[model samples]
Target: MKGSALTFVLGAQEKTCYYIFADKPNSNVGYYFAVQSGGSFDIDYTIKAPDGSIIVNEAKQRQGDWVFIAEKVGEYEFCFANGMSTFAEKVVDFEIKLDDDFKAELPKAPDQPIAVEGMQHSVDRIEAKLNDLIKSLQYYKTRNNRNQSTVKSTERRIFQFSLFDVLLMAGMAGLQIAVVQLFFKDSRKQLV
Candidate 1:
């Protein structure tokens, strides 16, 4: 049923109830969602089951949205990475819309099989969600970087102006001193 790793619902109004129908539904199903490399320029990332569950546990040098259907529901996990750097400053956004509310409807032994169009829809949903997420990431990252850069530049300019003011004050004081000294010396010579 679930053909893709993820799905995104844009302004999914209040509650139409969208859920990922897993391909291999079982009693032990653990789901996961995480960003690949966080907010880094070029960071390889690997994710493991956050709670040590094997739903998705491994160290990898890759990046992207990954979805895993495990053996259970409650043990789902999530993680992110920034392998390009060891700064641990990466911030990846992820979500888990877990549900145990709907069980697959089984046909009676005498009934014909239901042609539930789930897989196709799942793929479409995942793709749309992934694309949306990527776009949102780009938007937010650009905004954040620009804001920070602007703040930094403003701070630098303020510091430079401050230094200039100090230098100008020093120059004016020195000139005033020289002018006063010259006036005194000339006055004394004239008086003599």
Candidate 2:
């Protein structure tokens, strides 16, 4: 199994593409992406096979996980587009995995006992579970990043709104005071 993971900032109205070569046919290709911040946490993505055929197309997606078999041996294109966002840039996290359909066998020792074989099997199972746990941790980390971004955005908006509200209230109070003073001045002039 071969894989690459990346985190990049996609500028507004820009598109970026990456190529992954599949040396073996019928290999399992996995793609995963998440929008960590900016512009509703969404992006457009496309996966094209080496033959220029679109395997997956998505628009304004926040996150996605896709696994497909590569029937041809060639380069696959993965693209992320932020064209929908006119001004907001986006932070994206993505992973690509190429796994061949071959399981490695542990070399057997001539003097190896049955217990050692069982122990190897148990070790393989443990390794598989550990991989799963790692994947889960990565997913949670992504979610945490996105959630933190959302929280900061909301906090900024609230602060700005509160400031505006305070300014408006102050203006209204001053206007009321001026009106009351003018009313009293006009009444005194009439009495005189």
Candidate 3:
């Protein structure tokens, strides 16, 4: 069976992020996360077991990946925390993958000894290659998201700087005109 995957946007002022999922004891679970946008592009994250034990704690990280084995049979919680941020919100992308090791039962083919073994091997190799390709694509997607965040931040800074420059220029112009008028007034009084 295929695992479940989801992408969601976390809003501002969230102190904790939680995902509840059930896992059998000894099952392998994998999690990956990236902060696509927000203040500083970083946050704290934690993973808790059903009994409230901390499985993983990461401080001020922009992205991370983890793999762990479930030690008990129950619900587990995966969380991201943005408690340090007062004004800026965050956008998070994450995936939780389960490797249940379930093998599918296929119909038995006619006994063509050589062909059967070769075909199965070929299929397995192709599947492995496809998984690798999928992982690389995910990496690229995360990189692209980070680049977008950087661009937005730079744009905001540039706009603010431009506004400040305009205001300063206008103030300088006003001061120059006032100084010139003062000089003319003094000169006219002296000539009179």
Candidate 4:
């Protein structure tokens, strides 16, 4: 299987979609996705067939994985919607895989002098290990991205709060000075 992965931002109250074309019917396809950042780490996802029929639909989900066979030869629409967020944009990571015939090109062990049933076992084990490593790397990358976004958001809020605090203090100081000046003038008038 060969696939491509991408990370994208979905604007608030917007829909982001991609189309996949299956050249033939009954082709195997797999998909996985996750919300890396934004409100509650959640978003709505949908998969629609060429005929405009909904194949899969999920709401407020953080992650999902699925595999299916294409029923028709055409374009399929996959989408992520940030409608639930009024101001926060979402960062989403997704991957799509289509079954290919690359495995058929692997060198067979039949030409060896001593052919054993378990000869290909080592190769399979190594492949499995590599896949696991890739998954772990991807997971950490997503976590790092989410943390950065949180830091930026917190910094902005703190700046705004500090600005408000400074303005309030200045206003209070001006009011105090005005009251003292008024008290001194009243005392002078009484003395005169």
lDDT of 3 by residue, 5-79 (tens): 666665565765656465567778787787877788788888888888999988889887777887777777887
* TM-score-best of 2 and 4: 2
- Evaluated at residue 26, the lDDT of candidate 1 is 52
Candidate 2 residues 87-187, lDDT tens each? 99999989999999666767777797676788789988998899789678778887898889879989999999999999999999999999999999999
Better of 3 and 4 by TM-score: 3
**C-alpha lDDT (0 to 100) for residue 67 of candidate 1:** 41
Q: Model 2 scores what on Cα lDDT?
A: 0.91
Which stretches of model 1 miss by more than 4 angstroms? 1-115, 118-123
For candidate 4, write residues 1-192 as lDDT tens digits: 757789999989999898888777887878878788888788998999999999999999887777888889888899999999999888888998777334533455656724443556666778879977977777787778778878998999999999999999999999999999999999999999
Quickly count the clashes in candidate 1. 6
Query: Listing every candidate in turn, what is its Cα RMSD in Å to the true structure after a full C-alpha superposition?
Result: 11.0, 1.8, 2.5, 3.4
Task: List where candidate 4 sits over 4 angstroms from the true fold.
Answer: 22-28, 36-41, 50-53, 69-75, 85-91, 100-119
The TM-score, computed over Cα atoms with residue i paired to residue i, of candidate 3 is 0.83
Instruction: Give per-residue CA lDDT, model 1, range 1-192, as digits (tens).
Output: 222244322121111122333333353333333333323333232323334534433443222344444443333334333444544343333344433335454344444333344544566688779968965775565457546756777899999999999999999999999999999999999988
lDDT (CA) for every model shown?
A: 0.45, 0.91, 0.78, 0.83
- Whose TM-score is higher: candidate 1's or candidate 4's? 4
Model 4: weakest 10-residue lDDT segment is: 100-109
Candidate 2 lDDT at 32 equals: 82
List the candidate 2 regions with Cα displacement exceeding 4 Å: 110-113
Q: Which pairs of residues have clashing backbones in candidate 3?
A: none
Name the 10 consecutive residues with the lowest summed lDDT in model 1: 9-18
In model 1, the clashing pairs are 8-129, 28-71, 28-72, 29-70, 29-71, 29-72
